[model samples]
Target: MDLWLTLAVMAGAVFLFVTEKLRVDVVALLVAVSLLVLGVVTLPEALSGFSNQATVMVAAMFVLSGALQRNGALIAVGDLLARIRWKWLFLLVMMSLVAGVAAFVNNTATVAVFLPLVLAATTANRWAPSKFLIPLSYISQAAGVCTLIGTSTNLLVDSMAREADAVGFTLFEFAPLGIVFVGICMVYLMTVGRLLLPDRGVPGSATADHIGRYVAELLVAEGAAVIGRQRSEVLPDGSNDVTVLEILRNGAAVRGDDVRVEAGDRLLLRGLWQDIDATRKSMKLKFDHVARDLDGDLNAERLHVEAMVAPGSHLIGHTLAGMRFGHTYRARVHGLHRRQLGIRQPLDQVPLHVGDVLLLDAPVKAIADLRIDRGLIVMGSRAQRKVDTTKATLSAIVMAAAIAAAALGWMSIVASALLGCVALVVLRLLDPDEAYEAIDWRVILLLAGIIPLGIALQKTGGAVLAADQLINLVGHYGPTATLAAIYLMTSTLTEFMSNNASAVLLVPIAIATADSLGVDPKPFLIAVAFAASTSFATPISYQTNTMVYTAGNYRFSDFVKIGMPLNIIFLITATLLIPRFFPF
Candidate 1:
């Protein structure tokens, strides 16, 4: 009865998490607490996961990755996208490189670094960022599945493999299958599917002149002229050029056009640059001129410092108001370069989040002083000369060399990565304190919380029982069906949850099922890893996908329109390719 109940509870938790009814962190904690309280896990066993070596390794990697990112050691190879002569070939080459790099780094972090650059490239090359962003995100995820240290999934699978056999996965164990699969994907994405991608409503943006900046507000005064108006109706005299971006009334994230312009509801608008003065005059709109140059007032007396929101900063959650930037740091909140969602949004109203590159144009004197200050790590701004290029190159080389060493079995990926981190610090690529902020606790907690549940499932004989049922259902049709089923299930789960968690859950099942069938487990394991990592569907599906989704100013439907077909294509290919390569 306890076993059945436990299975039921676990299934329910996964379902709830997939449906997003409860927050993931909260769900993870609930599962951990329930296990401890019910005695399925003793206090030590339950708590032990938090301090697990795998969890620490994953966390440490983030900080090390951050060190490289803050110092600009990592440049988006997507910047080289302009080199491609053909558009389709360009998309393919870009995605391939991004995915390949993602295999060694966090895909989300990889996409975050590239989002601005991709946006800039699209503007430079007369292409839509929406098309490249999602593709790049998906590629990075796919690439991450290529190496043991590429993603947390590889790490989780390695840990599970060690427990199963004395010979665990080496770093390059995945390279053979990964290279083949990724190669096929690259060719297909470049040749066939690139033409199918949507050209979203984005235009070229070389200079500031390319952007539309207008000041129009929802007039909330009593008996105001623009009350109870639709988006089109609120616009001035049917020009169709002006737009109402948002209505901030009473601190709510609402989507309403006829929101009844009550008192205190702030309005946001965008329009043509030349018409801006006339429109503001005609509508009698009052808007703060945010695009004004920082050369005057306040900046002349002080230093102007710029910092990209380094990974794992204390500044992630708090707003400028809550952070007391003016009160504590003696740094005035000046300009910002924030991606409110994916593309650039007005920084004035932006609720600050992690990885936001803030253009802190302050006084010139304080600029150099702010460079190594505790919180804000300076990334070279537009006018700022590329500082310490030699150190940056050295840091990048160190990271790459460490990866190469780990992959070749000179040291554990964890040890190699940590050594690389130490080298980065020693070389002064990233400050010791700044490195600490780069670790994402949420992802680490998710890993720590879910690992024990996988163990519990194993202890309860759940994996074998599940395998037996799967065999009964699909074994007669043969192992091909079984592998396909496993791939599909793993892929669907990865799309809905974290790829690492999905890989962890499916690895035991795949190995168990393979043992039952008397076939090679490597192919099945590879299928699980690959399928779970290639999430091209929704922004919410993966971290990297989310990074680009907002930065490109993309609609939710855009990913579906772009990735759904690509996913189908990959799914069909995996079904055929897995058996041919490894023989299920």
Candidate 2:
């Protein structure tokens, strides 16, 4: 009866989590508290999860990731992407590279780094962000399959498995399935998926709704004043927004701007419209009005252009009317995408951020002058403002040392990462307030609340009972068949429950299955490990996917159309791959 009651309460909590009725963190904690009040678990056992090493490790990783991003460590890698002559091959290789990195880092960070990169890459080629942005986000989620530390859900499962059966998955146990799954995905994305991907960014946005319009490329004519000037000095007021989005020399796109601009070089300047014209009129520069004309009708001839609020862009959490962007930049207010649904209103009142694309209209001459200020991206071009990286060396060194120490096990991964955060503070690499703002407290709270409930389930013997049920259902078959059964079950559940919560629930069942078979638990455990982490069947399965769903302006069928096949691929790979690895 006690076990049944425990299961019923947990079922209710999961139902709430799956249906999105209550916040996940709230539901997780509610279950833990209910266990105590209903006598399902003792207070001490329920609360013990707060101190679990796994929770601390996950929390610490979040902070470290923020530190790295805040210190500009991840963005610095932007230089590594080489120019590709073939767009198809370029997209494939870039996807592989992004996936490889995500194999180690968190998925959200992967998206964070690559989202803007995709936007810049495609927009430069005159393709809409839609062609690659959704794919990038999708592939980044798939990257979690590559390794143990890649996703928090995986870590949570490993931790839970260890407690349940005194065993857990090995570091590379996922590689066989993951590599094959990623391989098929790569081929699909490069070919069929690419064709299926929408060829444009979202439209019908308010002034700031369309992002492509925000980025632009300009040409430096002969005898320009900035020809001999470095970015720091040429930047108006030394403001950070000024970015040299891209450079064209002799018809070739150059990623580096440190090279002095020569006569006839096409310059992609990411700045305000006012500065663009100021430079063109003041320095005798010209606009790539041809490029600008593609995304939207911006006639430098007529003196008008467009721009948007980018993801992680300084635009998020700020109102345009409050900041008086029009008054300060001398550009006319236009349409905004504004948060859709219940939050739908004009962008003039909406706060902007990294995923939002906005549309703006202003004088052609003013657009030309505004192009030099870095905080903005010209709608159709990829340009970066010159940053003073001389100080970046200190921040970089601190980050590297932290990673090395953690990887070498000289200190705990979380502790080493925290040390890097302190180093950033001492060096003043980023504002302390900025660092705090970057942490996603909602995710942190969700992880914290869910972890304790997992402890309760384990302590009350509910996990064992659940596992016994699964074993009895499938134990009649061989271990391999049982493994597939478990994988399928977890995958189906994850389509509704969160990947993290699902992992927590399924680990015990995996252990019980292993016990029933009297085999080395690694095989069954590996199946659970992989299954709980991959949820491509639905958009709501993972929070990261949900973020992309809204930003991409996609429908439920979009995920069903693209992600359903990916899920099928993962299931087959797991059923086949885990057995070969752990050898049940």
Candidate 3:
């Protein structure tokens, strides 16, 4: 009954994760709670994940990465990349730089910091951003597997291995095979992968210009020239770029070319920003201000900027009007850009999702506020912040020291990371609030919530039961083939779900399979770790991929065409090399 319960809960969790009906963290929490209630795990075991070393270290690393980002340590490198003129050289240097940075910092942050810089460089060189953005995301994942601290999945697998009484990996243990993977990825991307990438966006156009068309609601104010004009007369087809999709009278949709525009009527229009603006001026229409009175001091100098809703942001499901976005951020959302989706609803009523780029109009001072908000990644040229060179140097040194301490076995990774975070706060490099905000609570919660499911599987013998089925299917091919199977399964699952969740769910099974086969579990554990950390088949497979999806103006099939081949290559490489490094 306990084994059945554990399997049932795991199945349900995977379904929820893939469907995305609920957030990944929420699904994980449900899995943990379900396991506890089903008697598959004790209360201590159920809650143990929250206090796990991997969870703690992941949170601490976020703070350290934040310190580096805030102090200009990361941006300084981006500034140097902006000078490269040759396209090929820029691609080479950009990939190399991003990979190296990602090996130490969080992969998502690495991509986020360099995204604007890459866009700016590609625009200046007239290169298609789609050609380089996917590589940037893919290489970051490849590099992340090079170090244990490089990705949260690595730490989670290591901690799980230690708990199972197997020898865990060192900080650099993954580097040998990981570096080989990175080299293969770089070569493949430069040669074949380049051909697969779509040449999206117009040459020499600004990133904002490539955001595609948007849907906006415009009000026909009193005394507007179009007040008495027929709908066809105002937005005549083929006369201009703008098209009126629908007309709303007193909040109800009204259809027909015979309908005359009224002073209070709202027009749902679709067009480019320039065309939209031009239409508004010519038709004497105004933006339907959801929060009209919130726009304080309209005379102040305002700046137009693009900002992306970051992954794990608190604003994902809320509407602009519901959140009173203009009042909260003191910025009016002019338009929204979503990849390959035409938003037909009112702008303020549309719920924000990850990677949705918002066109914001705000006062000059509010730009800083937008930059500081963790929920938004302000696109394009970053506003210059006062950088303290001394603090920047110290922050780098502190981060290096923490990594060295963990690598040298001076302290456990969790302790070293905690100490480093304290040093940053003590040195005034990061405030306590900033440190707290730096940790992506969504990811932390996901990790803390899902880990116990692994415990439940192991305790209930569910892992062994699953391992028996895998063994019956592939164990006859010997340990090498079984190892290959494990890698393939993990890689495939990761492409569709949370990589960490995939790892947590599979690592225990790998251990059980190895134990049943009478071989070392280290190689199997390593397979799970590497496979889980390097998802490349879909933009939604990893956070870094999603970050670049809209910014690069890519279609869903764009990732499929370019990333599927890379995923297979990585699978083949890991299967061939992991054994040589760890010897099954």
Candidate 4:
């Protein structure tokens, strides 16, 4: 009965994870509570994950990653990479740099830091972002498996191994095989993978070309030059940059090109930022909403930026006007891009959703503040600011010290990371509040809540039962075949769920299978770690992929075309190499 109950809980959790009806972290917490309620795990066991070494280390790594981004260390590197002239050379170097950083920082954060830089580079080189972005995300996943601290999945597998009395991996134990995989991926992406990528993005100016046009409501101010002219005469077809989408008279839509413009009349106009600014200046127009709500002039030297609404943001489901977004963020939403919606309504009235790309116009100083807001991800900006050398140097030194300590056995991975976090705060590189916000609480909570399910599987003997079934299917073929099966199962499951969750669920079964076959569990554990970390077949399979999905303007089929082959390559490489490395 206990075994059946545990299995039933696991099945339900898997269903929730794949469907994404709830947030992954929320689903994980529900799984923990369900296990406790079903009496599959005791209260202590259910809560053990919260204090697990892996969970704490993952959180600490976030702070370390955040400090690097906050202090301009990563941005400085981006500035140098932006100067590469040739497209192929740029693509190769960019992936290599991103992979190196991803080995130490969180993969999502590494991608986030470089995203704007890559977009800007592509725009400058007249290259499509779709050609480069998928490779960026794929390479990060490959490099993440090169070191134990490279990804949370590696740390989770290491922590679980220790709990099950298996030897934990060294910091660089996976480096040899992981580096081989990274080389293979880098080569494939530059050669055959390049052919499969879609050329979807329009290559032109970063601001005027493909960023999309802005739709804003502007009022014809008193004494405006065009107040007495007909709308057709002032904004005739192909006459100027601004297109009058609709003419509003006292809150009613007035149709026809013959309608005469009047003072105080609101005209919904669409155009590029430069053209819009030129038309507004020439016509003496004012933003209808900005004039009514904001005290300052909208004509200040402004920065145009493209930002996406991030997942788990408080701003989700709230209209820009309802939230007073202009007042709250000190920025004006000029236009928005939603992949699914046509966006026929007023921009301010539309409720924001995840992955909505917002084109913003704000004062130059506001760009920094906007970047810090967790609610939005700034994809690109027109401004090029100077980096603080002092902070960048300190952050680099601190991150290096942490990694060296762990690798040299001077401290455990968790302790070294904690010490590094303290040093960053003490050095004034990151504020206390900034440090707190840096940690992705969703990932931390997901790890904490879902880890107990692994314990429950062990206690209920469900892991052994499942392993028995797997062995019955493939054990007769030899241990190598069983290893291949474990790797394939893990990689398949990771494509549909959280990689860390997949690792937690499968590691126990992998261990049990190894024990049953009287082979070394190290090979199986290594397979699980590699398979779980390198999720590439779907955009939703990994966070970095999702970050680039909408930004690159890619379709669902783009990933399948490029990533499926890469996934198979990694699987084959791991199967042939894991046994040789650890000798099953």
Candidate 5:
């Protein structure tokens, strides 16, 4: 009964995670509570994950990542990126820096800190971001496996291993395999992935050219000649090559081609510069117009900014008309660019999703205000401001010391990370409030909640049942076959679920399979660790993948086109190398 219940719950949880009907953290907590209600795990076991050293270590890493970003430490590297002129050399330098930093920092944060820099670089060099953003995400993932601190998934695996009374991985234990994967990925992207990536940074697309090319709502004046005319009469199909996305009547989206233009009706239009000008003159529309002050300061004082909506932003699923965005922010949203979906959609009616980039016309102050707003990431076209070298140097020193201490066995990895975080705070590199804010509560909650599900599976004998089934199918093929099977299964699960969750659920099974096979558990554990981090071939597969989704204007197939081959490469590498690293 317990095993069936556990399997049922796991199936439900997987379904919820893939469908995304509820927030991932919420779904995780629900799984924990369900385990308790089902009597699958005791209260202590259920709550043990929160008190685990690995969980604490992961939290501390978040603080460190936050400090590095907030202190402008990582931004300092962009200075070197500014000097590269050749495409291959540009990718080489960027990947080298990304891999070096991601080997210690969180991969998601690594991508976030470098996202703005890459956007600015693409704008300056006249290159498409599509050519670089996916590679950035891919390298961050590949290089992150090189160190225990590179990604939270590694920490979770190590912590689970320790909880099972197995020897945990050392700080640099995974570096050899990680370095090989990074090198292979770098070569593949430079030679093949380069051609597969689309040149999406087109002249009129907001992802590339964010200025002047806009889709705006235009209100016809009370005396305009187009009033009372059929929408077709005013905005005929392909008229001036301008597409009328929607007509807002009484603040609700009405038909664009069929409805008549009533008084106060707003028309949402998209077109090129000349087309917009032609349509404006022919229709006598009154679009959003910011007037210059008596001193004519509008052009100089106002700023046009393009910001991508972040994941978990309150703006998701809410239409701009419902949010009163213009009233609340005192800004005008000139355009909306969505991934997969083209710009022809009606902004006032279409619900917003994470990664949708909005172009806004606002004062310089509003642009600055967005820095603190968690809802958006600013993709600036202008050159980035100089990073504070003092803070950068201090942060680098503290980070280096922490890594050295852990590697040298002078302090535990968890203790060393906690000390580094404290030093960041004490040295005023990151303010106390900023440090707390730097932690992603969703991740903490997800870890704390889903970890119990692992305990429940083990305590309920579900892990044994799973191991037996897997072994029954592949045991005759030998332990080598079993290791590859586990790696493949874990990799597939990671594409549809959290990598951390994948690690937590599979580590015990891997250990059980190894023990049953009369082989070292280390190879199985290491294989699972590497496979969980190999979340490629889909945007939803990894956090960093999602981060670059809209910024690169890539479709779902783009990931598969580039990432599937890389995934195959890593899978083969892990299978062949694991036995070599940990003799079976």
Candidate 6:
């Protein structure tokens, strides 16, 4: 009964996670509390996850990541990479830099720090962002196995191992396998992956080479052929080359479908400049002076900029129309860039979420005011500000010290990260309030909420039940086959659920299976660690993937085309190498 109850709850939670019907953290909290309410776990067992050392370490890493970002450290490093003249050399240097940084810092933080840098570099060098952003994400994942602190998955695995009375991994124990993975990734990207990467960024860029499309207002001249037509009728039957987004009747915005075309009506349309020019001649429509002269008016006293919605921003899950964004912030919303979708939706109707970049026309004062806003991180601007080099150097020193302390066994990963956070604050790299804001509370909540479920699964014998089922299926195949099966299953689960959640659920089962087979548990545990981080086949599998998804204007198939082979390679590598490293 207990096993059935636990499996039922897990099934429901998995459904919620995959569908995204509820926020992930909210789903986590629900699952944790539900286990307690249903008598599956005692109160203390349910609550213990909140105080876990691994969870605390993740929180501290967020603060350290914020400090480095604020102190201009990441930007300074990116500037040097951007100076590389050779394109191939530039890719090598950029990937190496990302991988190296990611090996020490959290992969998500590393990706966040480099995202804008990659975008800016591509813009400056006249290269498409698609050529590099996905590689940046993939390399970060490859290097995340370098150290215990490289990813939350490693820490969770170590924590689970310790709980099960198995040996825990040292700081750099995974380095051999991790280094090999990084080498394979570097070679594959510079060779095969480069050819598969799409040139989507250039076409989706705000400054496309051919001026493919622009959001413009056009005045409808009197007695045009399409005067009384509905907006849909104007572009009917799957005609998608041009779109009528909005209509202005007497200077008041109206929906394109609702409004009839009047003699002097103004319309907001998105299309190529050449198409607009041709339409103006045929339909007798003239470009609105205010829209055409955006540079002279909109940006004269204001700054035209792009800003990404940071995780846990108040803007998530709300539409600009509902927020009255333009009136509130005095910023005109031009468009929104979303993963896999590009800028296809109307601005007002589009819902905002984390990692969605907004193109805004706001006064310079508003932009300055928003610079410190926790809700949004300004990527770059037409007018740039100087970075504080002194703070950047100090921040680097503080991070290095923390890493050294952990690697040298002077402190645990949690202690080292907490100490680093304090040093960053004391050194004024990030203010106390800024540090508080920098911690992604969603990630913390998600960790705290789902961790108890691991305890529940073990205590209720669900893990053992699941393990027996696995053993019955794969026991005769030998330990090598068993390890490969576990790795593949874990990797597949990660694509549909949070990597941490998958790790928590599967790690216990892997340990139990090892015990059942009378083989060493270390090999199984190591397989879980590598498989959890090998989430390359889909963007939803990993946070870093989602971070680059929209920036590169990638399709779901793009990840499949580029990341699937990488996933297969890692699967084979782990299956072959894990047993040799920790003999079973």
TM-score of each: 0.76, 0.69, 0.89, 0.83, 0.85, 0.84
Residue 328 of model 6, lDDT score: 59
Off by over 4 Å in 5: 202-235, 239-304, 310-330, 338-354, 364-375
Cα lDDT tens digits for candidate 2, 346-451 = 3355555434444455655556545544334454443443444644566657756876786676886557767777777677765677566555554555665666
Enumerate residue pairs that collide in model 3: none
The pairs that clash in candidate 4 are: none
**RMSD, every candidate, angstroms:** 6.2, 15.1, 3.6, 6.5, 4.3, 4.8
What is each predicted model's overall lDDT from 0 to 1?
0.64, 0.62, 0.85, 0.84, 0.80, 0.78
Ranking by lDDT: 3, 4, 5, 6, 1, 2
User: Where is the poorest 10-residue window by lDDT in model 3?
Assistant: 202-211
Model 4 global lDDT (CA atoms, 0 to 1)? 0.84
Off by over 4 Å in 4: 203-291, 295-305, 310-323, 332-354, 361-375, 382-385
User: Candidate 6: how large is its RMSD?
Assistant: 4.8
Lowest lDDT 10-residue stretch of candidate 5: 288-297
Error of 2 at 88 (Å): 0.8
lDDT of 5 by residue, 1-584 (tens): 88788888889989998877777888888888898899888898778878987789988988877777766787668878977888889988999999998998888888877887887787678888889999999999999999998988898889888888566899999998889989999999899988888887743456545422446677878887778887667774445667777677765677745678876777877765456657777778875443223223455577667787775456777887789777666677766665443444446666777777787778776666676565677877534445788987898888888889999999898899999999999999988988877777777888898998888777778787788999999999998889999999999999888888888889989888877888888888898889899788899888789878767767788999999999988889888888887789
**Candidate 2 ranges with C-alpha deviation above 4 Å:** 76-85, 168-177, 200-415, 418-435
Task: Tell me the number of clashing residue pairs for each predicted model.
Answer: 19, 69, 0, 0, 0, 0
Order the candidates by TM-score, highest first.
3, 5, 6, 4, 1, 2
User: Candidate 5: lDDT of 252?
Assistant: 68
For candidate 1, the lDDT comes to 0.64
Q: Tell me the spans in candidate 6 whose CA falls farther than 4 Å from its real position.
A: 201-306, 312-314, 317-324, 327-329, 340-351, 362-385
How do the residues 1-584 of candidate 4 rate in per-residue lDDT, one tens digit apiece? 88899899999999999987677898899999999999989999889999998999999999999888877787767777778988789889998898899988889888877877888777777778888999999999999999999999999999998999556999999999999999999999999998898887554445234344556677888888777777676663443566777667776667765778888887777766567767777678876656345436657677667888775456777999799898888888766666544444566777876677787778877788787776787776433445788998999999999999999999898999999999998989999998988888888999999999999899899999989999999999999999999999999999989999999999999999989999889999999999999988888898888878878877778888899999899889988999888898
Q: How well is each residue in 317-382 modelled by candidate 3, as lDDT tens digits? A: 899989989988988887777754456666777888888888887888888888767688876655
Give the winner by lDDT. 3
Error of 2 at 232 (Å): 59
